[model samples]
Target chain A: MDEFYHLIDWALCLSGLIGLWFFFSRTGGPLNKAQAYMSVFREKGIYNPSYGLAIAFVYALLDIALSIVIYVWFYNDYWTDSDFGIAHLGRVILLYTIVLVSLHVFLPKIDNRHLRKTINTVDYHKMGLSMAAFVVVCVAVEYWLKRFVYGMWYGEESESILATVAVVASTAWIASSVYTSLNRYESIKNASERTLGALKTRHAPIVFLRSFVLDKPQRKGMTFDEYICSTFALNSQPIVSLSDPDDFLPTGGSIKIQSTDEEWESAINTLLMECRAVVIFEGKTVSLKTEMAKIQRFHIPHDKVFVATPPQNYRLAAWNDGKITERKYTLNYIWNDFVKALDTYGGMHGLPETDPGECMIFSFDKHWNCKAPVKKTGKDFLGYVVDQTVVHENDKCDYISLAEKLNRFELQHTQVLSKSDEKRIEKAIIKALIMSALMSLAVILLIKLLVK
Target chain B: MTPTDFQTIEESLGSLFFILVLIYYFTQLGRLRHRKKLDDTDGVKKVKKQMLWGIPVFIVLFFAMVLSSSLLL
Candidate 1:
């Protein structure tokens, strides 16, 4: 037994010494796996800082666990077996404070530009003080929790390792896991809010129309007032004739809901929010040149707009010093062009049928689950005859208003991740942390009580 | 067995447990790198491969130490 003990002890002692050598050197050696593992985390450090901090916290905590195990192993070798002094525990914790801070702070700061940006040259002392405070706290936990616990357990003639198992497994893992979860939760919340904000502030759609359309025949042969009723109704979509105050208003036009010349731009802004399609009749007396420019400025997608203008002798393109160029076409002309576009577009894509306007029926999630049972049939969402992401496919419902509350401040009428989604993720993170704590507790108990 | 022996065996087993975890985590990292087609950082690729090989060897060695200590009369 003495010979075997000496043999195995010599081997472990040699390997441990080598591992220490490799670790301190930070060379391409056995410790490279550790370095590689860290670099993987470092790669993600910039774009998602909170997630990166979570990784760092986890890695530091795990390293400390491994260090504790190694410390216990070495205690018997360096000191009298299992009769370690408080000074030795202090020394070990002091070493961890140095090593963990180096890895977590200094190492990241050295190479990562993102980490470097955290400190201005002038604020180095302040940052240094904060970092020192953090390290002091970490070392205190390592020292007090392990050393003091070991003292009590040792007094009962229990092994010193029992204390380490308790501290490293239960206390350390739980604290680190909870911290990581909170960091990730804050990150996701901020990210979700930023995305939703961008969506809300976006410019809405606009439709251009001629005043003649309100008073003229509804369609090619129908005579109803276009405002009260229209011909060739597309799923009963109203041909809302949005007008400018500058346009020549023939009598009997629909401006019972009208604005004056001073409020014309404001009126267009209002229409930009609500108008779906514009049908401008290209006659001798009407034009929507400013409204067209506003539509261009808002970046309204072409599919949302259709223009109708009379055929001209020759198309003209604007030019200035080889830089300025634009094709001048009336909204009415664009309407005819849009029909051509629909033909070419539908021939290749088989779409425009599934186009979502102001609202939708069943949401993407619901549509997916409902359609996926047939498996491959619903791959093309447009091909599905039913409109999704709404209640009962009601376009008139103004689903955005009646939409489910996403969080305290907003509603989700579309497929973008809502605050509720973020909350669900946060809850999952908490559940995972709790499960990890429970598992760590179980293992700590098993290890500490196993000797009995 | 002496308390000293228990301590030695426990240390070996504890080290084995930690190493097992490291191996599992490193394996996950390796899988992640491959899945994401990640480029290797300085010395990481070589060390990762070496560690992958070295861990199992260490695992076996630690297991032997624990088993032999546990069986000693």
Candidate 2:
């Protein structure tokens, strides 16, 4: 038993090390799964109340099964002991059931609130203190419960109990993270689908074109597509994009059209003719340039297409020791390549010269006439600019500016949503939420009964 | 090797892992602070906020490991 315990400890330590390494190195894990699940939901039209409840129930059953397997494996000896086995298992299950219920009920609300606000320094400090207090409280409760409630019977085997709890809690935490990611994906998909349905009625769907790099989580943990969707969630038309050839799962923000390499050009041409607005994010790819040429050939109205220029460079002001110093970001190879490609294509000819160390998005009109570049100002959901001291002069063009420009155009053509359409979407979302909540409650009650 | 020797090696590895993790955490906090200062975007600020909790939890974990080792000894 001592040797087994030692082995388990070593395995845990090694696993922890590997998990940290994997987290830092990988980008596609839960996000990819969420995206894949969203794709399936869209294809199957499974966002209804009954479907949501079924999915939640399936996940809950899986969690219970996994937990049981782990518990029995760890306490195989204790199972035969009988006095402490079933009773202790019951308590652990009860604790986990509470956690699962709270996760389903509160996590979505917290995530929604997080999406709507700009976190500041005071908020960070408060969050830190709260987290510390929560941890302390959890530890205290566990210690008190073990000492006063079950410590007498399981006194010698406290270590095993603690280990089991740690394992169970870790598993539950991972499961909850996945669940939350999927829930967020579902919400985004729901909003996107609703917008698309509205736009289809008017034949004015927004078309989003970008280099594949924009799909990646660059310096920001979020993909540019996600940033755009969240920024314009309330007002903008549904944005759609061609799925990247290499992507296994469609990215979250834009509705992705799956097409073959040979079919993409024809697809883009068709979309360009029908789309109300075209958002072209600057990129260096040959396909993007080809698309640009096609846009020119199609003679798309200048007001209908918006070209988002990339930042030339960024200037970061940092405090080193006691003194403040300015540091200019070195031009990355990709940006340099992009500039050269744009220049060669004469796409940069009439555009305003971007200040050497600042980001701006320049809109163009018909005959390739350029508008004044939009500069970052005011606070939006992501707090575009919070501190005056540190300036992101070289950061990518602000999504808020792009969103504002698009929304301005969209509002000109916007018709107020009919009462029926509005009510239908709202009812669907509410029903799905209620069903999922009921399913969670049912799972918790079932677990409680089984444990008893 | 003897069991004591294995135990010593394990303890050393554990301590080293914690120390490395602590260094990484501090570095991340510094980068986030710099990003918050420079960009001050909500995303950066949110991540920096998360680090506030992250730092405490990691520190607590480190201390717990040390305490557990001492108790075992």
Candidate 3:
């Protein structure tokens, strides 16, 4: 029980190391995301200074929070025992204050051109070096803390031991940081290609079928469904959907039987959820192509999208020439070529589950709690989010189920929605405050009456 | 009302008042969740998930420790 505090202390110490990593190495890792976000707004004419300031402000506030949490339990010790713990708490407050002040005052003032150049680059070697520094710093601090505590128990001073250890560790970290900066590993290799190849070799598959629209009449007077049926002969398991344009009805019990226009967003979101690979007929309407772009933005590998910018890529028939299967002038031939491409680049047998650290097949929360699809024949724990259930003719459902529903009657009447229309911060704190006050009053009155 | 009477009532009803406020706030958060934009999905749900995971575990451990300490002694 006495030693439980040591665990908390050590955890906080490690957290400080993590916080420090997030602090200085704002070029890669978590801070890289913030910069990417800021870049978007920077194009929209937001002040460039705001980017660095935002990163530093977030870093400072998080560290200040970390410091407070680390020292809060010591308040009990101060009141019950002595002022020693309070002194340590004061030190924590001071440390966090210094960090906050330094970042808030200095980060924006860093030469803007240099910052811009540096921030966008992803230096994996720099990240590796930071990890090394964290290990070294934590090891030294833990050792010094142990020695100091042991010395205190034995009524002997160990400040010299602690100082020597800390200094050596910090110096080593500084050297490593400098080395990483000077000798950056410039391996521009696609890291995931090897992993994808491995999945192919293991027969983990990557096969896909999404909307195959032939809005223009099929060549040689063939119908869209007839052409689709011919393509499915190559792999009977893969069925091309002969969809109704108005079949954008959701698969759940939906009150709003949204028309085709109303269903577009939900339908596209569903495609992004289910289909990893997409094939859109080019030289046609831009709608399907737009859907393909959205999936690509969802970070489906580039090779997964096959658009026959026809006359160039349009095919009719294909021949398997031992090593390669060559295609002829047929639409099915284009699909055959695409299947081969998918087998090569995407994967042969497995679902398009991203390897660890790569973006998942479908995850809305890009910031956290991302789960990739499970590989070949394995189902991902993560599934599609359904907005409604209007049952398409093909019975091809992307929706898992409705998570919940909002009270539109009340929500529409609320004064302030989100900070911006685009931003969906759904919690209405002002209304919540009013409700809480009323509830509190009602409870107070009820309690008073009951007591009387 | 007299100051003494106010103080007496306040002391007795304070915990009840706070509990009701907590309930109201949680309910309102749940209600507001449905109003989220299509792309802005899982806004309040994420916070709810964290709280659901965190609070009960802490409460259980707290009560367990207190009971164990007294019982063992």
On residues A1-452, what C-alpha lDDT tens digit does candidate 1 reach at each position? 46755765676677566555544444221122233434543442322233333433443454356446535543343454243444343433443343333334322222111111111123323433433344345545655644664333554445656755654554444444334433333322322222111232222222334433323322222212322222222223322233322211211212222344445556555555554443332222223545555655665444444333221221111110111111222222333333334333222122123211211112112111111111112112222212221122224423133112212222112222246644553454344334443444444446445533
* Alpha-carbon runs more than 4 Å astray in model 2: A1-172, A188-205, A216-223, A231-240, A244-256, A274-276, A300-305, A309-331, A350-359, A364-372, A376-452, B1-73
Better of 1 and 2 by lDDT: 2
Against the true structure, whose TM-score is highest?
2
- State the DockQ, from 0 to 1, for candidate 1: 0.03
lDDT of 2: 0.47
The 10-residue segment of model 1 chain A with minimum total lDDT is: A314-323
Per-prediction DockQ? 0.03, 0.03, 0.03
Candidate topping lDDT: 2
The CAPRI quality class of candidate 2 comes to: incorrect
User: In candidate 3, what are the lDDT values of residues A291-379, reduced to their tens digit?
Assistant: 54565456654434333222221122111111111122123333344434433333332222221211123322222222333221111
**What TM-score would every model get versus the actual structure?**
0.24, 0.37, 0.26
User: Candidate 2, residues A61-177: lDDT per residue as tens digits?
Assistant: 443444444344433343444544444445434433443343343322110001111111122333334333433444444445444544423535886578567645644454444
Query: What are the lDDT scores of the predictions, listed in order?
Result: 0.36, 0.47, 0.33
- Model 3: DockQ against the native? 0.03
